[model samples]
Target: MPFAELDQPGDDRGELVGLLKRLGLRTLGDFAALAERDVAGRFPNDTIIAHRLVRGLSHRPPLRRALPPELAVTERFEYPLQRLDEAAFIAKALGERFFTGLALHSLACTRLAIHALTEAGEERVRVWRCAEPLTASATADRVRWQCEGWLARPDDRPTAGIVQLRLEPEEVIGGQSLQLQLDSIGHDVDAAQRAARACVRIQGLLGPDAVLMPVLDGGRGPGERVRLVPWGEPREATQEDQPWPGRLPTPSPALVPRQRQPVQVRDAVGDVVCCNDRGELSYPPAVVVVGDRPARRVIGWAGPWVYRDSAFAKQRHGRIQVSLEADEPNAGEVALLLNGAVGERPNWHVEGIYD
Candidate 1:
């Protein structure tokens, strides 16, 4: 609501309001009802200004005075915080106050950093990031989670009691853009903000690396095309958009092993299958042995797709994907990647399981 005093009677305006009153204009509403052109002509420049103020077009104390400083709310303990519960309560109260200040200014924090100082002068700091603006409840939950995790780790706990806590906004956006109308963000925006909050809490409980977000990059291989980064950390740049010759064709493999596991592919004649120098398989796969599992017959197989790495000689490799005749428990229509090069027997490993 607009300030009531802007339109109230007996405001400290001098002779202008006195003349308006003498002219039977008692309230600001009476002055506002006058035509702008008439008000501009009948009285001094202040009369036009008063009319605009009454109509809510101009602020009594203007909004253009100065932009507020960045949000940095701090709470200092007279007696240092000894218990985790005490720190958590302080954090909750701080979050409420901090976000409340932002709300008053029509602003919201997109990135926030938490700083904790111990009596011994040691400090622990971590920044939390979000795609959408965070709510105060989410901010408090994150703070509590972080405090709990720090207390739980005896090795990393504060040497002395914590004397000060600080919450600083690293980045902020206009809250009006996000809060002006419900349809501006839709329902998914709320869900996404909640999910981000949960992720922040989980990351606090575990280490930062525990929660990762996938980033797509330009690369020839399936594994190279995507990377996982820890939450709140900046993503490393890669040639993700670059076109490369001799890259594997899409649709790429759904599963790629983090650590390659070795197995054996055998022909019906009990000969180990091999990829020749010409990138051709010596024999069709019949039996597959994966990590001491009973040999399963091969149902179908794809290719000896060669991948050449000009930068590294040892990295040059070839791969063949095959379907197993017998499915492993919970792995329907199991597929295996047999990867190797010429003059060496190919090693079979589970690639992916079709649903």
Candidate 2:
């Protein structure tokens, strides 16, 4: 139940969840730890339920209804799945098909039951509970994580290949609340407009900063580019289009640390990498070590770019992009943003991580 999954809350869906996820919420504990008032200040819409759900409280039956048996979708694999990854791959398609069926009925499900049949004639089952309707992709991921957890027990691992999988909708509600309804036909609520009104109401209650929203601003750094302002205000950027000479090139980092972590950048000869008075490197960066993380070889890089309006600025720093073997949860090529003062001292810090 991470913040990303918060949007998949049994009765919630909107840009609010996305915002929190981007703010570095990694698990249910992270969001649940926040004060309800702080969350309400940003979302304004019914975040009370999200706070309750994150704290493991159930408002389930109050917002959801019983689903019909027709919403279940099953699939028999042509190739039996011996590993959890194979089962996970098949679940993705099954989830999409299942939700498609639900959509036809103008319904969405909050609780789901996953059933599996093995070639040895054994059966496995588990139920997934969400405070809100989950997207098809989220449903598939939940099943995959469940399977991985179950399969992780060496002694309890399935003895035979899985031949069939079934997804059943145990609880459901009208599909209307999951996304903005723009159809001009019926009495469907305009979700976007309602969210705006909620923001206004919250601002009136908590004062102007009660509901702030993010707007992109002109800056060379990804962290500086994001600006949170009071909601319902004009977010005009007069200089975003202006060229920033030393800005780190796109695409931007996916994760920016709340605080910059001290790091060591080394050269080919094992000497610490440092910049000269002219902001040029003493030697090209060849390796990087952030905090206590394993050293990563710098295979590719850009910059040593400086940030200052004038050469004499005391608060100036240089930025660099280094591509290395990923040290992240998911194994992919990672690019790091590093910052250092514009001087001979070899101090450096990790500015961002591209996942």
Candidate 3:
């Protein structure tokens, strides 16, 4: 008989061992001399099994229950599920079944593994781990979320409908005790769980690239100081040293592109007053038509101030560009401006502005 079958609640292993240890009946032959009723009276609940074991009647029966190598639940669909919604529904069901089995064993899972089989016989698998053991509903929700992510990828979609789904617990561990001192600060594990769930769901529907977080790169330039990366990836929280001298203490919220347009400035008297080049502006301006005609004029001017080139994009020509803000009444809106010389016309183009 399998060891698992012998380990059942009413098996003679425990009582026989206990009685033998107490009476010094170490051998099976010694135990076989004991009367059935005598052993039966000694252990009320397991007497019959204990007597059989003492009589050398092969107390172990054929294996009745089997132990799984690992805790898992699997479902094979008669029909393949083609839609993401259908797959998610099946995932949820599988999650519940998987968790139900774990709960029966008084176990909680910290890691979840999902597997999918397509009608074309292709298999896809994904694994996720959490900091804490999760409930059945939470586990199911996470499985669904992970399924959506796998389905969202262009290269990951199965050629045929998904015909198989499985959820397996990959890790099991104990839960941590809550800290009483941190209660007033409102930091709790539930919030983390909710955030994890939300992230998984969003990533499932929109792909992992959709979620991002800011990281510090530790350089003097706007491009150098900040970087965008996937939400869960580890990144340095702060920068240590400056890359260049004369860095701005306050960085602008937005990073405008380097390429811009150039413009010829004409004054109110209809004379070419100035040509603005290599200039930068902080904001957009109000635009109007010059001389009441269709031609636009910049009414307000801000800056031709120079700044360092963006670190995010490489500068091939090695020239720093200036940003400019201008108001053009002809455009009938305040806008931001960038100018680059366009074949001697010195064309003026509106970039964007505050409302």
Q: Which candidate gets the maximum TM-score versus the true structure?
A: 1
Point to the candidate with the largest lDDT.
2
lDDT of 2 by residue, 1-355 (tens): 5556666546555576676668887777988899877876776546766777778777532657576457788888787777767767876888789889998988987777888887888898866555447678767665665566455556667787778888888888889857743674565446754565556445433444767777777788888878887765557676689787677778888888999799999999889888765768889999899889898899998878887744575667888889987667688887888988877675799888887
Cα lDDT, model 3, residue 209: 68
Clashing pairs in 1: 217-240, 218-240
What lDDT tens digits, residue by residue, belong to model 3 across residues 1-355?
A: 2222333575437644665668776556666677776776776555566557546566556788877656788899998887679866876778778877887677777777778888888988776655457777777787777766666667766678778888877786533322234654667757876787787677666755677777767654444567886645556655556455434344332543344334344445554332333442223433333223354546555543333355563321111223323345464433343332322233443332233
Comparison by TM-score, 1 against 2, better one: 1
What is the C-alpha local distance difference test score of each model?
A: 0.74, 0.75, 0.57
What order do candidates take by lDDT, descending? 2, 1, 3
Model 1 / residue 352 / CA error / Å: 4.0
How many steric overlaps does candidate 3 have?
A: 28
Over the stretch 1-355, how does candidate 1's per-residue lDDT look in tens digits? 3234454565656666567667876677777788988977887776677788778786344556677675788889899887878968987898898899888888888788888888999998988876667678867877787777776777777788888888888888888655546565556666756677777778887878899988877765667778888876666657756766556655667777787667788899999888765667888888888877788888898877776766566645667777887555775667766566555645555543333
Worst 10 residues of 2 by lDDT: 199-208
Which 10 successive residues of model 1 have the least lDDT summed?
1-10
